[model samples]
Target: MPNIKSAIKRVKVNAKANVANSQAKSAMRTTVKKAENAIAANAENVQELVQSAHKALDKAASKGLIHKNAAARKKSRLAKKA
Candidate 1:
């Protein structure tokens, strides 16, 4: 319960950003998991899935949802797996 108008606005903005960040992070994780599973199964679409995962990681990192180094490491590991 923010008493000041500014504080109230800040709370609303923060809540919106939180939801957006959560969705982005969730999508990134899902992409990575799909790639990992495909790699484990030796699926033919492994390359596509891994590529999408890399793209998702890059997007997340660029958006500051994740650290750039973390994104790079994940991408490297995913590539190694594929």
Candidate 2:
């Protein structure tokens, strides 16, 4: 435990941020997976799913949740897979 008041506050803030970042990352992964599944199943709405996945990846990248290169790489792979 942080004994200093500011340290304690910082710890709390970091904890909250961790939770938020984890949720965002999880949602992004789910979006990407949905796109992949649509590809595998040859779903009619695959385009829409891929678009959604791209949006999610871009959003996460812009938010600094993931590296821009990582996002770009994933988007490229998704496009190739489609």
Candidate 3:
């Protein structure tokens, strides 16, 4: 539906970026969930799970997929739960 050539190119780039962003977000959520579940189940490896979650959050933040404060908050909460 884009009338200009640049607009058409923008649309294509936006679609690709959207998919990449979505995948990163999904992975971040999954890592957080795994950490939470480990805590809830009273797993002995909670520390490892927390570390994994923190790594994922840091990576997401570094990639500009999430705010640094948001990532810090999540890491703090996960650490507290563990």
**Per-model TM values vs. the true structure:** 0.98, 0.98, 0.94
Ranking of all candidate structures by their lDDT, best first: 2, 1, 3
Backbone clashes, each candidate = 0, 0, 0
Cα lDDT tens digits, model 2, 1-82, are 9899999999999999999999999999999999999999999999999999999999999999999999999999999999
What is residue 18's positional error in candidate 2, in angstroms? 0.5
Query: How many pairs in model 1 have backbone atoms within 3 A of each other, for residues 3 or more apart or on separate chains, i.e. clashes?
Result: 0
User: Which runs in model 1 stand beyond 4 Å of their true positions?
Assistant: none
Give model 1's TM-score versus the native structure.
0.98
Ranking by TM-score: 2, 1, 3
Worst 10 residues of 3 by lDDT: 44-53
lDDT (tens digit, per residue) of candidate 1 on 1-82: 9899999999999999999999999999999999999999999999899999999999999999999999999999999989
The 0-to-1 C-alpha lDDT of every candidate, in the order given, reads 0.97, 0.99, 0.94
Candidate maximizing lDDT: 2
Q: Cα deviation of 15 in candidate 1 (Å)?
A: 0.4
**For model 2, where is the 10-residue window of minimal lDDT?**
2-11
Better of 1 and 3 by lDDT: 1
lDDT of 2: 0.99
